[model samples]
Target chain A: MTGIRRDFQKILLALLLGALLPASAWSKTVIGVMMPGNSAYFQEIHQAFLTTLTAKSSAGTTFEIIVQKPFPDPVALSNAARKLLAADPDLLVTYGTSATLAVLHEKSHAPVIYGGVYDQFTAQLAGPRATGCGFKIPLTSLLRHLRELKKVETLNVLYCSLEEDSVRQLNELSELAKEQQLTLNRINLKNREDLKKAPLAKGDAIFLTGSSVVAAMLDEILALAKNHQQPSVGIFPDRDEAGITIALYHDPLAQGRKIAEIAAQVLSGRAPGDIKPEALRNTELMFNLKEAKNIGVKIPFQLVAEASKVIK
Target chain B: MTTTPIANSRIICRVIVLLLLLLAVPPLAFAQTRELVIGIEPEHNIFTQMEEYGQLVKYITEKSGIPIRLTIMSRYGEVLQRFKAMHLDGAFLNSYTATLAIDELGMAPIASPVSLAGESVTRGIIFTRRDSNIRRIAEMRGKSIAFVDPATTEGYLFPLALLKKNGITDIKTFFSHHFFTGSHASAISAVLDGRADLGVAKELVYQRQVAKDPSIAAELVILEESPPTPETTLCLKQDLPADLKRKLIDIMLEMDQSREGMAVLKTLGLRGFTRADKADFNIVRQMAKEAGLPGRTSKRQ
Candidate 1:
């Protein structure tokens, strides 16, 4: 009788273990995402990430996403990063260079996947627990496009000198201009009120950099440039929708998909450091014909034809 | 008769539990195994085609409550073979293959892509480099011509039939040489590189290419445009349940109006999808017959 009782107890224990094993194996993966703000660009990247993650999830595996509210400033970003790290998520996904830097600063063990960063090298995003994709519009391509639109003998670039990424981009543009034998005029925006005081000369086209201050003050700058009849080019492709004559940038949707693929690799047991961070390869060109006409620039048929999107 | 009342109650309880357990098992098993397999013709590389159609498959899965598995067949014939084996639950087929599937495999035409202009038809174009001395189809008596693929309707059949109708029959002897370049882009490249004096492609692709490189306009000239052909079709297996078929057609037809659906359509280079039937592809059948392609109706007629 005691032997039979022992056998029954063993069977019961085995059944309980079997039930718990599946529950543990099927538990959904938790991904915590930190975003800079709810800007349209960030939202697009977020949407692409969700769409791709859903599409790539395996049959039995599922995902649970925890998103931190948009951090408006550097302090807010740092606080959010600390709080998110406290949650002990399986992985962390961040957007923009500042937010990514904040997460890296936390020094969490969770793997970090980032997107929409301008320069990953300068951001120092490569580490044992982090990998990301960057978007950098090559200056040579932008200048070549500008040269095709009009004979740009002299180009003026307006940037906020405080931003390191902006300064780097300015230096790159200046070097590229030297190679092309075109004169580049550097204009510094010390503050918001400098837009009205900046020297705008006729026959000098404007080059917009990837600067937050410049983005915040784009409307006034564009109005000033238009008033001066200076055809302007921007780094963000969607800037064309806001009246920039020519905008060149990497495809954000593709970038999001790339980040998701890397995340999938990490989730499937690959170390994050094993995956090398990549820059976006596919570039999209946008042209605003109406802006071209307003600026008294004739966009060549070839440039107009090659554009991925055109705003009239 | 001699059993106690408590023993009878226990027996009744055990019988009821057994019945409940039997009732739950079949549904769990069915849910675990249910999946919809969709086959697509490889117009582009498999990865790209999958990426483009990813959202469409997801949308279908969400609406139909069925998991969708996509299979990209490397060739047109492989898709037909898989359908005959009953391995595919549905397929996205070109007009010719859709017509064949409807006639031979009992497939039902559920939906087809429509252009942004609200047109459900596409045209084939024959083009040559502007510097090429060949002016017309008749002038290409001894020049090499490039075609996308023999199985491609607009890229091969329509354009070839147009040439034959213009009295350039006996292609082997009429043209010095002809070759299949495997894709419309390749055919265009072949012509531009001067390997072939003329090439044929779909009008929409040509226009998109020109839009991306206006230099094509300065270099290549459209020599002829074929008559309009019906667009590609999304087909369903006839054996699918009536309610499920209705749900799928409704989801596809309403795809473009929603944000997620619009993204899928844009990726697939389509404006939207519209409900379709077998009658819409009669023109494709006629074109196939004219082109002398081998299929059920072509063989029968």
Candidate 2:
């Protein structure tokens, strides 16, 4: 009986140490977020994410968000990632595909969560310990608007080859176009300069997705769209200010909040895979009627009634 | 250091340069072209038949000032699936399909077909053998009833509405046996074959039969006709661009007076499209909801 009691005591001590050691060892954790440095909006998203995280966690839970700027810089991103791993974050939240790849190559036990990314399967960004909103912009809404406008058939879209976001969205849109039996013509813009000269096809409307390259060239893009007498749509709401016809946009603020919620789940010891990835918290369909009519497109009142916002 | 040209010659040269500029910039640049794709079921070859019926394609283009193209889908299920896949911009859809579109696909009806009488609604009629004893919907209890495919707007949806209105649910309690015939044509065939004691169809379907065989009408009397509901209409895919979608709606509502458009209208059995609010289809959607057939579910058509 004494031998049995001694064995049980040893087992209990071992278990206590096993749980305590890992908990105590965790400190000064760094959370890496990959984002575009060129845009202030992404900064706002990062700020909201951190604020929400700090607000929710127990006081004195120390963590830092390390944002790696302007993705697709493999070497610099790799170095930054290594530094982050050395700091040893409890988890990593990747902003987009470019950022995700950089973090993925580095060997780290930290769980990964991809934020503000699209085409989860094709991108292969749903890495181990990966769970985040796939953040797909509403394609159905755009198609529906086109149908309502009596312009149902073909579309012309411009993409930046260097921008992963544009490539990702183009692939998804092309797939949808094939299913709907509409033709999608791709116009690749190599740089901001190339964007200005890209020919606008007759009988085609312009569709673009969220890419810093696209965003920076918004003035030129809008001019091209207007010059072609084509209605244009962007994937991000911010693009609306830059003069796209409208944006079928996903709210980054909501996306940030969602990421915070998922991060909390991971911090609470939930298995990342067990936490099924969530879609964006909300998506809105917006239109610019002023822009529409300028391009000779008539706006339907019924569609306006359902819009989150319409710039008339 | 440059010498001035003669005034008349310079003026001519300037005029030529201006003409070249005008020619270089195509007039099409001034025309706004908004394009979207609408998916339609192959029923009656409505999408392809648009050219023959109303020059629907040309009519919409002239009315909306935006060219429209119709893609004929093989089945209603394909329509919903494409909508989900974000493939279609809009669709010409039935009330049943629209119900699913609104709930699941985020689409809303902008316009629906109007009958020759200018009535924008249709009804479902539950019928039985005129010589048989089933006189009312309740008499349908303990009798085998035939339904069209569970997704059909009329044969399944409207009959279900009539059943619910009469406080006769628990389908098993009312009918000893039930089966779906896949379409209105199939359900009518089932009734004619004596395979089922009761069946459901559109009210207009019964009238059409009366023209071909008056005795057929005498053979089956309407057990119940559901309240009038909206006819099939145009639906925008949930995420279509708003301004552009609006233009499409405008095109549809104003298609009546155009000569080429009128022919398309006649074939679809309508004058032209009418403006619709979400409230217009509330009755059908509400009834569907009450009958516990809400959304794109297995029990719903």
Candidate 3:
């Protein structure tokens, strides 16, 4: 705790030094973006944010963006937040719930815009200088659809304890399992070693929670699941790329454009408190028909017909 | 008891008469022995649609005291073909097929399913992606369009009528390319993913897709929406008993009032059924007329 406090003090002094720059040095607006994990989803969002921010800006306006990608652990998250604060950007852009909280934990006066968090309502991720977009996917719907793909007596949930969104999903799945008359096998994958140490996966199916840690190890998990001959689902934009049987997730491009909208407003001298924080409820459900075929499972025709996208 | 010769002869005559009656009026005999078969074409998926139709058939049979059966048609385009070979008392037909049936076979629409939005009618939509440069019908020239099946009123008729009204009589000359998506959701998906520059589909389906994936709203923009026209309606053969049709319509329209009726509706994914009349399908008729669609004679011809 003392070490973190000392780091915070150093970051504050650096921010003070940044504030002392000349007017010419402040001609171009600098925005610091800190992402917990360098996941493809985050990268897509960051790219969209940049594209939209550029498109929505004035004819000649350009931003000097400083980005930090850290491994999403507690210490790394704090360190990433401190590094971004040292830059003392005009606004702080964060992806994911933990990254947002890390910036908030710093107690920085810099305005913050967050995106890609799940169920911001439950987390109350509101602050005086922070406003952005998040999403709420129906975890129960994911479970229901997964069961339709295969008769699930036992469901294996792969989540990371370090990610707040994944933990919330884990808890939600636990409740849903009771309602659906299903037994849950919770797998907390904090690191790569934890995944290696996981017991033999014998569940009827596997569910991939929206954790970067878990997403990073998706190929290994999917391989093991296929070896067990179990169908798998995910709560991200896996899009059949990693052989996830089903994916129900928010549209990252939508969230990216929305976050850019908020960030642009903050840069244009609008208070974050004035802009209302929004939670995007638009979720896309996709079925990877080829993946199901590989796992020797069949997705119901109704589910296939109802999906927004089907990869065959 | 001893049987008299007169009684024995009377029994023989009665048996011969019964056999002759069955042979002479085979249609009436079949009607007496068989349930009313109502054929349905796929709205999205045939399996789910059949299940919903099954619940509806069971409900109507119980309430109207008319034994009803449902038949899943091979394709939406095979309505008149199926009715010709099969003894169908009625069918749950979409606007285009119902209009064609009304013209060719004298089928009258009695009731239409109320969508989950509480509306018994739906509209046609012309849409394209938000990032696409095609907004006006003129801009769609030399660009591909994704259309639902030709048998669908909202999918094909609406756009056809719209183009004709704009003086583009020949689609082959105007459009660079076009294809049918076989389903409304697929048609919308085509435009959303940039597979097609423009798409025409049922407005209710577009709304449902947007509800499921709201990002669709963020990505696509509607260029035009047609006036509300009847959705799928329960059209019965004109030769059916008038009292039976009345009873079925009454039972269907009252489905939202009773718990048992509501349960059937829950399975059907519908709020309720609403009474429909010939005037409700004027827009479809107008579109067909504008599109210059030829009405084919019944296969019985």
Candidate 4:
């Protein structure tokens, strides 16, 4: 009888405290962000998104952001999604295609904001209640730029089997390479250990797909490339000085700004379904002339002139 | 033997023939056999410079029927010295070095490469970030500065002259720190990234960077711009055969007229070459004079 009376008294005391406190004391908007990894591209997007979101915030509205940087894999990404869902966040933000899908698979009610995914519609990652910005870059022009730097024979493609978007990019390049009459050597990097299996060789170039796995192993892959004197091109511009001989990709700044716009609309009580998704086509083309020189290749002037940035 | 006037005449005739043959052989051989060795000044990228000059040299050799070889100087200031040390027949030089080479080495300006925009002249610019609070020369006092190579007019001499004209002498004390960034692009980068408070670079390079990255346009402002100066000019040795120099000038000036020539010009990121006279370098000479650069060093060029 005393234990039951004590439990009833505790519940009454919590109800009284809740009634006395302001709603904002416990009703802060919580946003959870799922990142595939700490890739420079994602970090740039995330920073810009936060800055814009903070600036656009209303007078009294507050945000509580929970960021989860999970190792780029299916299981970890799903676990990250479940953890975020458990928070009952008002919105879920995702960077990279893998994380976006993992979050979508959980059937959450919160609006989803996705960024840094390559070809969102083509990869079938887009869905209802998901309004955000994704990017599309021309792989043909990337190959053309690579060819301008050197005569590519057996183009080595570095991709991860786990990343759906990465696999989509690789498959796209493979089809294009066939049309161009160029041979391809696809090296699948499933995890960290697979980085050592890449056969970095001479007289050919490496094409790095937008896979988190490849990005995680970029340093070692580029080192092997440099050690073997094989030039490389990539879809991601890592810090603008990844020793990537050629890079052509959408600007992270543009993607981030667009994402923040969509997110602000959602925060303003608009339906995610009402806000139409947009695609970013503005791309940045860079040539690492220094790396080219290190590998004993001279980028022609005509092509150099075309690059948006040349690291001389 | 008996001394005779006829025998003496025959000996004199033979001597005259031998002397005439000796004189004729050397002139003919020098005119035909000697290959022209040209020097390329150090630029932002050696490989780029080499590829550009290499394609031009190959084209010129094929067209002019004269063997031409290219050599790159170790640095920007060695053009005139290497002209003597390496027996350089001519060189493609920026306005600063071209002016110095003309005044000191007696080199003649043959032609200048027109930019892809068809501009044969470039200007010097002093720039800084809008937020850097370095709007004027007075504001640059005690601040860091990035200057391009001393061998470039737009990079170094023009800025130096402007500062002296503003009465800010003794740069060592005027600025807390100053160093050469070696390229106009580097100087612009230093200013944009806040590595330096002020930067002096070629206006062409600055514009090129702005075109590449639009954010640079928002971040930086041009504080000053010098009068137009000659772009890279082909300055040939004074002793080169007049015909050879004319042939080179004609080939470059007429490059855009033919398909093959246009292809080569495209490779070098140029529209074509235009005639450049010593008078075209007057702007550079005046800038150098204002900066008090002549005879500043024993190896001035």
- Measured by DockQ, the strongest candidate is 3
Deviation in Å, model 1, residue B153 alpha carbon: 26
Residues A5-105, candidate 2, lDDT per residue (tens digit)?
99999999988887876542555556876675354445555677788888888755778777667544567667767776776777887776666777888
Q: Best candidate, TM-score-wise? A: 3
lDDT of 4 by residue, B1-301 (tens): 6979999999999999999987777532565567888888765556777888999998888888788889888667789788777778888898888888887888899999789987999889998767556788899887878898888898899989999899977899999888887677767755654456788988877777677656577768899999989987889988877877888888888999999899999877789999988788778777777898767322323
Off by over 4 Å in 2: A1-28, A37-41, A73-80, A138-140, A147-154, A179-183, A201-203, B1-301
Error of 2 at A274 (Å): 3.0
Residue pairs in collision within model 1: none
lDDT of 4 by residue, A158-260 (tens): 9888887789899888887777788888899977677776665633989999987789888888888888788898878858486988888777886888898
The candidate 3 chain A region of ten consecutive residues with least summed lDDT is A21-30
Interface RMSD of 2: 19.4
* Alpha-carbon DockQ of candidate 3: 0.07
The 10-residue segment with the lowest total lDDT in model 2 chain B: B41-50
Tens digit per residue, CA lDDT, model 2, B116-200: 8888888887887664567866667778777865665677777776677779777877787787754554455456434467888
Tens-place lDDT digits, model 1, residues B84-177: 7757988887776777788777888898888888887778888886755568777878777888766677777787677667776678998777
By lDDT rank, best first, the candidates go: 3, 4, 1, 2
Candidates' DockQ values?
Answer: 0.01, 0.02, 0.07, 0.03
The Cα RMSD of model 3 versus the native structure comes to: 13.7
